[model samples]
Target: MNKPIYILGIESSCDDTAAAVIFNSKILSNVVASQKIHEEYGGVVPELASRAHQQNIVPVVASALKKACVSKEQLSAVAYTRGPGLMGALLVGSSFAKSLAMGLDLPLIEVNHMQAHILAHFIEDDSQTKPDFPFLALTISGGHTQIVKVTDYFNMEIIGQTIDDAVGEAFDKSAKILGFPYPGGPLIDKYAQLGNPNAFSFTKPKVGDLDFSFSGLKTAILYFVQNNTKTNPNFIKENIADICASIQFTIVDYLMDKLKNAVKETGIKEVAIGGGVSANSGIRKALKKAETDFGWKTHIPNFDYCTDNAAMIAIVGELKYKQNDFSDINVASKARMTF
Candidate 1:
């Protein structure tokens, strides 16, 4: 067997400050420090996220190393999220990884935050099996909603994407209109269980082909709530569950419709989902149903891997290390990047 490779991954791409240590394709430890401070603001403040990352990065990395029972000296390379996130947040991770790599005389590997969400499936774990190459990937999260054709590790094509607000934004924004707190996606999911998905109807946008647009749905929800609460006053309280269920169903239906189309267009039966939104119960059930309903195989990562985490970054790092794909010390964090 070849010598085991150890990669230290750092991810501060958004509000979560995370670190992980992977050895020989297996994760030893994964640590994420979530910023609860953003709750009061109803959304992430870039400046605050950066400051929190600065405070948490060191301890988070140290905690990961300790949990992994691996020391920094044994690491083979340092991997960090390079972009498609807030500039300040991305810089905190990239800069930390670069400096650590320099001090350790190790190579630096840059990972795309979006790609990390997809590559997360490759992380060695006993419970889950990785999808084969050339599979279809649906990446849905707060920032992105995309369908990708994965031909290989690091070889991916965006087959479809959202033109406006992503599905997560739809969920959160809809919840806000319902008077829910920030990070209300999970709350919507929780309330949706007892409600009727068909209780209300929202118009799905007529975006062409596989492209998606949730801005219209968001506006519709806003107007519906405005119109209903005008006379009833307690409309939201009376029908919160039904409204949430309806909204969640609408979004999931839109996503599933496009995913079915992507499968038909590509003739790829292997379907997989990633990113934070994949954790939704409704979406998970839809993907599971596709297996029997449409004769397609599906892959869903564990809940931990679904969100923005360093283990995903480490998996990509390991793949790049095998190909000798290393980034120079001068590499900088990008707020907007592709693939």
Candidate 2:
């Protein structure tokens, strides 16, 4: 058997300060310190989010190590999210990883936040099935909504992506219009279950066959609510469930339509979804139905992997570690990156 490799992963790409310890492709422990303060502002305040990461990074990492029953000495490399996130937040993780790797005299691996979401499936867990290579990965979250062609662990190409607001933003923004709080995407999903999906209709955007756009749908919802509430006054309260259901269905259907286009374009039957929004019950049900309805194989990660967490980063780190792909101490954090 090959010798075991331990990698320490840190993620502070947004409001969550997370750390994880991985043994090869399996995760030993994952710790995340979420910034609840952002909920008060109705959205993440980048400056505040970074400050919170600075405070949580140390303890979070310590907790992950303790939970894994592993020491810093056992770690073979330090992995951290390097880009395509809030610059200040990304720096907190990248800087700490660099310093720790330097002290331990270990390899430093910088991972892309988006790719981490897709690579998260490779983590050896009994509850989840890993996707095959050359599969289609639909990454949907607050920051991105993309369909990527994954040919290998490290080789991925974004075949389609949102031109404007991401799907998560569409959910959250729609929730806000309905008087839901920050991080309201789940709330929308919760209420969507009780109402009729076709209660209201919002026209899907006329984007390219593969690309996506949600801004128009968001505006349509806003106007619909405004027009209805003008006379009814209690329109939202009276039809909260139906409104949520309709919105959720619209978004989820739009996503499926795009996925269908991707599958057709690539001729790939295996599909996987990652990122925060994959936790949506509607999307999950849709993916499951597609297995039987469309004859496509589907993969969904556990709820932990769906959100912004360190396990994904650790998995990417492990993949890179095997290839001896190390980053320099002078590597800088980026606010935007592409596959």
Candidate 3:
């Protein structure tokens, strides 16, 4: 029992094939193989993504083990994302992790992809501060947008969630309308800093105070671009920065508003954010500003953990492993799962 617990984590929830090794609470190494093929199609193609995972997962896991200076035999268990993603993509990770665990006679842990994003904060790291219990977690990503109430390592409640398109989709779709390439969320964030946020305004959808809806916002943006370009063919080119800034501004503002409401309802002053969108510069700056303006504490994981990476899965695996939580040999992946 005194020996360190090592977990080999695998994540293939989407286009990224990730693997990581965690020693106790600290990450020893994390590696991700991103599928650039998705960029050509403007979004991930599930079949292609699964095939890429098949090709990349082995090398990625090997690299993680090598970098961590640990052999597969040293690992106490294998953890992998099991659901709420493309079925084919989820299968690649599940099948590999199951096989590895069985081969080693080790425990196999099934992790919720979304839950991993929230637990990522607990990964022992010098660069980040862990959130306290009962804090609010704003999870923003391409496929999900939810406010989770984390009361413990495993006890989490989704107090609020999107009714339609997730925040990341809103960002990417808006950027696409601007003629930006696939995975345009980051591009939107980059250009946002160069222009005024108020240069263009998009109305936030009228969803319930806790629930979010971004489909309408995407439609609004599409029309705005279409109408504008009719008058000036070079409209987007001339005002790309301002347009991006404005879209980013509205999305961040809407997210903040929901977080504020959650805090009010739960009386939880401590806030944490996770998921890919958490890396957006505007949201990070806004969280920093909230610490001063609202006297609230905030936590944001390091950039690497903010995205869909295996380190998060490893950390969650470590937590569940502590509780003796293990899945059976019959465990299967789910295309749609809930925390």
Candidate 4:
């Protein structure tokens, strides 16, 4: 621990195969190999995703170390995502990381995928902007929708979460209803920009407190599309942009409303957002508006770190490494893990 520590982080929790080398607290290189094979199927096929990770893991890790100008022998420990993702996908990274750690006679660190998303903000960079203790983190991703209270690097409390489907599902599923390709959240954001956000209306869910429910919104959109298309088959074609804008507006508003409630309840003005949905332009704009209108400080990660990536995992690794927190080799991957 006297010298700088180099921790290699591997994340294969989903469709993305990522690896990163963190020296001390700085991320030197982060490489991600995204699986486009799932696009044709309209969503991820766990089997295909796991196989793609098997194919990409080795080269991705090698590329990250090479880009960082670091060798495997110099690493202090190996860290990997352990849960809250597909079991097969998590196994690919966890198995590889465990094997490498054993081969190198180094320690192993296990990280929760969701926790790593929130910890991503701690990755040291030129931004020099970090959320202080007791900040609120809105972790919006494909599989999760949570509002966590962060008091320390590893200490977190999920004050709010989705009661049903996540917000990302709302965006992607809504896009599917509109005939967009898989992973259509970004495309929705793109089209929403060209249209009026208030052009159409969708019923927002009435989930009380900090918990959320996007299933209602998704159902509403589906029924609306079906009902309208019955009258005019070209309904979606003629109002694609406007429909996207309105859908995006509802989702963003739902998220912000719950966040405001959390702020009022916890009295925490420092807010940070992470996960894939954090990359949405509409959500980013809403957070910026909150900063000005609600007098809150917001922390948003760079686009590169917004999705499933090892850079975030590496930062968690660094934090645990400093505290001498190492996982035993027998640690297993979990598909659904809490905290």
Candidate 5:
């Protein structure tokens, strides 16, 4: 039998710095260090995020290697997120991976961050929900909203995308307007549980077929608050839950509407969702319900795997490595990496 290939993966395309070791397709260790510096600013500061990655990458990689008990010489290849993220953050990971690969004389794999997100479904230990080819995937995150058609490992196409703000960006911005702290998406989700989704009605923006536009929805919320507060200054405080529920419902509804249309247009049954926003409780529940309602199968990654991580990068890297897909040291990070 052939010895399984061991690969090291690095992911510093955003606020989190991560590293992981994988043997063949199985993950051995995954370590992520997140920067909390953005809390005071109510959003990620790109330069600060990059500086934090520079400081965290070395130690993070060391920890992953130690935990996996793997040596540099044993690594079959090194993989890193190549683009579609903060330029400085992507530079840190890409540069480190390139240097390490050069020093170790190993092949370097350039993994697209979004592609890694979709491939995250294959990283789970549970074998029952593996997605087959030509699958439909809805990838929602702070930076991107895309509906992808995965024909094969390397053959994926973006059939639909956001025209304005991403779904998660709407949640975060709404949370901020509601006086929540930075990284407000989770806060909104938490408070939403205590409120009624039907308490208020928010209009779903109509952009185009298979495309999304959250700008109108966001404006609607802003105007609603402005108008209501004119009558009662404490209107938001008095009806916080209902507001959250209403916003959450609108976002989920819009996502589902686009997803259903994509499935109908593509005529594919195997559907999956990934990226940071995929971890949203409302989105998860709605996707599951859609599966039953539309008679389609759904695949979602575990909570840990749903967010930015190196394991997903390693999984994508492994797939590429097997096909002898490698990148040169001169490969640069891209700010808008597309499928």
Candidate 6:
């Protein structure tokens, strides 16, 4: 802990293969190799994702080290994502990290991908005030959705989660129905700017407290389009922008509603969000608006930090290293990890 702590972090949990170098909490280099193969299929295919990671990891890590102007011998520890992602993808990063750490005689830190997403807020801008203990976090991604309570650096409790489809999944599916290309959530946000959010009303699903159900909302959109298009064949084509806006509004409202309720129940003022959907413009706007409306402090990672990246992994690794928390080579990859 005396010398400047430098860590090498690897992240290949899903489609993106990433590596980063961090000196203490400051990120030196962050490199991500995104897979373009998934674009043809509308979503990630596990086998293909693994193959892509295999091809990307080594070069990604080398580039990160070069960019950071650091050599392998200077690293104090090696870190990699160990779970809550595609099993094959996780294995690629975990195995590589283990081998590198062993060869370098360095400690190994296994990080939870979701936990890294939350900690990403700390990496890019060290000036941002750190969230207080007992802060509430909302993590929304394509595969997962949950409300978490962070009691400490490594202690987290899941208090609310999706009973069915996640909010990001709903957004992508709705975009598909609208004939947008794969990874269409961002496109929806773009087109929505040209339309009115109140142009149409979509009913929010009635799910019990703390649990979210986006399946019903997806169904409603399907039926609404089916019935309306039957009477007016050009309905979707003519009102695409408005429909996108309306759908985006409903989804954002649902997320904010649950977050508000979580704050009310937990009685915690510090709030933050992480994961891919956290990059949505609507979500960012709503969170900032809520700060004034609800009189609560809010924290959000930058756009790059919000999505899958390795800077977050480096930050989490730095924390684990300080606590002497190390992972064994026998640690295995997991597809679904719980807090």
TM-score between model 6 and native: 0.97
Off by over 4 Å in 6: 124-129
Q: Could you estimate the TM-score for every candidate?
A: 0.98, 0.99, 0.99, 0.98, 0.97, 0.97
Note the clash tally of each candidate.
0, 0, 0, 0, 0, 0
The local distance difference test score of each candidate is: 0.93, 0.94, 0.94, 0.94, 0.91, 0.91
TM-score: model 1 vs. ground truth: 0.98
Clashes of 4: 0
Per-residue CA lDDT of candidate 6, range 1-339, in tens? 578899999998889999999996888999999999999999999999999999999999999999999999999999999988999999999999999999999999999999988777667575455677879999999888899999888899999999999988999999888888889999999988888999999999888677899998999999998999999999989999899999999999999999999999999989999999998989889998999999988988777787788998999999999999999888888888987
Scored against the true structure, residue 335 in model 2 reaches a CA lDDT of: 98
Model 6 is weakest, by summed lDDT over 10 consecutive residues, at 121-130
**Model 4, stretches more than 4 Å misplaced?**
none
Error of 2 at 265 (Å): 1.2
* Model 5, residue 270: C-alpha shift (Å): 1.1
- The regions of model 1 sitting more than 4 angstroms off are none
Model 2 deviation from the true structure expressed as Cα RMSD, one decimal place: 0.9
Candidate 5 Cα errors over 4 Å, as ranges: none
Q: For model 6, what is the C-alpha lDDT against the true structure?
A: 0.91
Worst lDDT window (10 residues) for model 3?
A: 1-10
Lowest summed lDDT window (length 10), candidate 4: 121-130
Q: In candidate 5, residue 39 scores what lDDT?
A: 95
Output the TM-score of candidate 4.
0.98
Clashing pairs in model 4, backbone N/Cα/C closer than 3 A: none
